[model samples]
Target: MSAPESAPPTRPPAPELRGAPSPRLHNEDLAPRRDAAPWRTWDLFCWWMSAWHSLGSYTFAIGLLVLGLTGWQVVVALVLGIAVLLWGCNLTGVAGQRAGVPFPVFARLSFGVFGANVPALLRAVVGVAWYGIQTYLASLAVMTMTLKVWPASQSLTAPQFLGMSALGWICFLVLWTLQLAVLHRGMEAVRKLSDVAGPVLWIAIAALAVWVLARAGWSVDWNYREGPALDTAGTVSAIVSGAFLTVAFLAGPMLNFADFSRNSPDARSIRRGNGLGLLVNGTAFVLVSVVIALASAEVHGQAVTDPVELVQDIDSVTLLLLATVSIAGSAVGINIILNFVSPAYDFANVAPSRISFRTGGVITAVVALVVMPWRLYSSPVMVNYFIGGVGALIGPVFGIVVADYYLLRRGRIDVDDLYSDSPTGRYWYRRGTNPNAIAALLVAGTITLLVAFLPALSALAAYSWLVGTVIGGGAYLLAERVHPSGSLLPEPAAVPAQLPTQR
Candidate 1:
C-alpha cells in the first residue's frame, strides 16, 4: 500500500454483459463489478494495507515526529488523520457497495456521462505525474541497493541520459515493466498481490523497528524532539497540521474509493475492512515508523526517515534485501493502483470503443515519460503548486458526487439509464453534460486554489479540502434547485425499481 487506489484493468475486455452502457460507451473494464462473487472483508482490508503502508508513509510518520510534538501528540495527530481516512473510505465505499460501479461511472451521476470523462482525465493526469515521480524515486532506492550488493555496478551510474544515470534508467524501466505485468492481469490479480503484500509489509515495518530498538541500547525515547519544545498553542497547531496533511494525502484515493469497493459484497464489510486496515493497521504502522525512525537516529547519529537509507546503514545483506525490496514493492504497488489503474479506466472512458484498458494504461506510462517526472519531483515547489492545484478539483468532485447521490437523488439510482444515452435517459443531461456540476466545480475549485496558493490564506491551507467539500456540495445543491439536473427522474424512489424505460 502506498498512497492511493483504483479499479483493475489493462487486459483485454471480457464478453459484453447482459446490462451494459451503450456500445460506444461500453467496455468490459468499465462494466459494473461482476456478480460472480464479492470480495471478502480480508481482501478489502489487505488493499488498504497494501495501498497505504509503504516507505513513503514510513517517512511521513517520521516527519510528524520531527514536528516537535511529544509522542502522545504525534499519536493523537496520526490517529485523527487515520480516522478521517477511515470515515471517508467507508462513506464513498457505500456508493460502490450499493451501485457496483467505478469512480468514472459513479461520477456520471453528477457530472453527466460525457462531462465525467474530463474529471476522470484530470485525475488520470495527476495520477500519471505522481506515478512517474514515484517510480523514479523508487528506482533510486533499487539502484542504491543494487550497487551495495555488487560494487562493480557503480560504473553504471557514471553515464547519464535525460538527467538520469544508465543504471537509474534500467531500474526505472524494470519497475515500470513489472507494474504493467501485474496490472494487465486486472483488479482481481491486484487483490491477490495485496493479500500477500499487506501482511509482509507489516512484518517488515515491525522488524525494522525492533532491529533499530535493539541497536539503540534497548532504550526508547518518549519525546524525540527535533527542535525547541513548543507551547500548547504551537503543539496544537503542529498536531492539526500533521493530521491535515495525512488526510489530504489520500484525497486522491478517497475520492475514487468505490473503484476498490465496487468489488466488495456488503457495506458491513466496507466498514469492517476500513476499521481494521485504516484505523488499526494504519495506527500500528505510524507507531512502528516512529519507533524505527527515532531509534535509528540514536543508532546512526542522525535521524533517518527513508527506510531504504536506514536499512543500508545497518550493514546487513539480509536486512538490506528484505527492507529495500519491500520498500520498492510498496512504491510499485502505489504506482499501479493509484497511478496506473486510475488513468487506465479514465483514458479508456474517453473513447471506450477505441481504447482498451491496456492502451489507456500505456498512454499514462508514455505521458509520464514525456513529463520526465524527475524534473517534476526535483522541485518541491512546482510539485506542490501543480499537483496540489490539479488535486483541488478532487474534493469538489467528491462534494458533488455525495450531494447528488445522497442528497438530491436520495439514494435512488436508475442503473439502466446510467448506461443509456437516449434522449429520455435519466442521466442524459444537456449534451450529456451537467452544467451544475461544472459550475459547482469552478466555484469550489477556485476557493481551494486560493487557499492553497495565496500567502494571505496560507493558514487556511490545511483545511482547504474540507472547505472545498462544503462549498462545492453547497453550491451544487443551490445550482440544482435553480436549474435542476436532467439526471433526476420525474418519479424516483429511495431504491429505484428496475423497470423497463421508454428508450
Candidate 2:
C-alpha cells in the first residue's frame, strides 16, 4: 500500500539555484515556518476553552439532555464524543506541526498542487456558514441586553427585513464589525483575546451554576421524561446518535485543525493542549450545561436551551448583562479561531499571487453576509440540513487526507512540490490534479449526500459522517491500487536543498 516511483523526463533548476523569485506557489503568508511557533500547551488548552464556551456548544449539550437519556448516560456520550474529537485533532495536528503549513497547503500533498482547491474551497464555504450563524447568535445576545436595559428600544423592532427585525440588523452589523477588527490585527490579537475570554467564560458559567443551585436546590431531576420513555434498545440508540451529533457539531474544526496546530511549538504541545482542551475542558463544559438545563427546568418551569434566552430569564440586570457579555465574547473567540482563520488561509490558497491573507478574509466575511445565515438559524430543519450536511461532506475529505498521509505516503511530503505547478513535480499529476483522489472524494461524498438528503435513508442519516469516512478511505486505497501513482517516498538527493527550516 505504498506510492509508486517513476523518473520524469527532466528536473527543473531549483528555484534557489536559479536566483528566480520564489514561485507563485510559495507566498510568505502560506510558506512553511522559518521562526519558532509561539503557541504552547496552555495556549492550545485555551483555544478549545474559547471554542467550546460558545452558544452553539450550549445548544448541543442541551440537545443531548432532551434525548430521554439520564444525566449519567448523557455524560458517557459526551466523554466518548470528545474522545473521538481529541483523537482526530491529534492525528491531523501532527502533520501541520511537522510541515509548519496551514491545512490547505498541507492538503496539496494528497489532492495535487492545484486540485487541493476542492477540499479547501469546501472548507471555506463551511466556515462562511458558521461565521454567519455565530455572528447572528452573538447579535441576539446584544439585542437581548439592549432591550433589557432600555425597554423603550423594543418598539424599534418594527419594519422587519429579511426575517430579522431592524434592531437585529444593527446588532449583527456591530458584532460583525468587531470581529473584522480583531481579524485585521492578525493572529496575535486573536490569541490574546482568547486567553482573556476563556477564563472569563469559565467564571461566568461557574457563577451561573451557583445561582441555579441556590434557586433550584440539589434535588433537581436528571431524567428527562417529557414524553413516552424509551425501551433499552431505544435508549442505546439515542446514546449512540447523541455521540454522533456531538462529532457532527465539531466536524468543521476537527477537519481544519491543522490551521491552528501549525502554530504549535511542537507535537508534544499539540497533544497536551488538545487533551486538556478537548477532553477535560469539553467534558466539564457539557456537565455544567446539563446541570444548568436541569436547574432551569425546575426554577423556570421549562428547559431553556439557548443561553441568551436563559440569561434573559435572570432577575438581576447585572448578572444578565454579565452573562450576555460572556456569551458574546465566547462566540467572537470561536468565530475567529474556527470560522475566520481557516477560510482566510483557504481562500488565499486559491489564488496566492493575487489574494493576500487579508483579502481572503474579506472575501469570507462578504460571503458570510450573502448567505443570510439568520434564516437558516431561525429554522430547526435548516440547522440540521446546513450543519449536518456540511459536516457529512467534511468526513470524506478527512478520510482521504488521513489515509494518504498516514498509509500511502507514510507521512513524507515534498514541501517544494506542494507549491509547484511544473508537470515534472511530484504533486503535479495530470495537469495538476489527481484523478484518483477526486474520484474517491466524489464517490464517498455522493453516498453521504444521498443518506443526508434522501427520506428513505432518514434512519441512517445520523451516522452519515462515520459512514462517509470509512467508505472514502477504503475507496481511495482501492483506487490507488488500481491506478498506482509515483512514490511519495522522498529521495534525499531529489529533495529541495533550500526547503524552509522547521522550528
Return the top candidate by TM-score. Answer: 1
- Please give the range of 10 consecutive residues that has the lowest summed lDDT in model 2: 1-10
Alpha-carbon lDDT of model 2: 0.79
Per-residue error at 136 for model 2, in Å? 0.7
- Candidate 1 residues 153-236, lDDT tens each? 999999999988899899999988888788777777778888888888778777777888988987767676778899989998
Best by lDDT: 2
Q: For each of the candidates, give the backbone clash count.
A: 5, 2
* All candidates: CA RMSD (Å): 5.4, 7.3
What is the Cα-based lDDT of residue 62 in candidate 2? 77
What would the per-residue lDDT of candidate 2 be over residues 249-355, giving only the tens digit for each residue?
Answer: 78878988887777766677778788888888999998898888888888877667887777787878887888888888889989998999889989989888888
Q: Candidate 1: minimum summed lDDT over ten consecutive residues — where?
A: 494-503
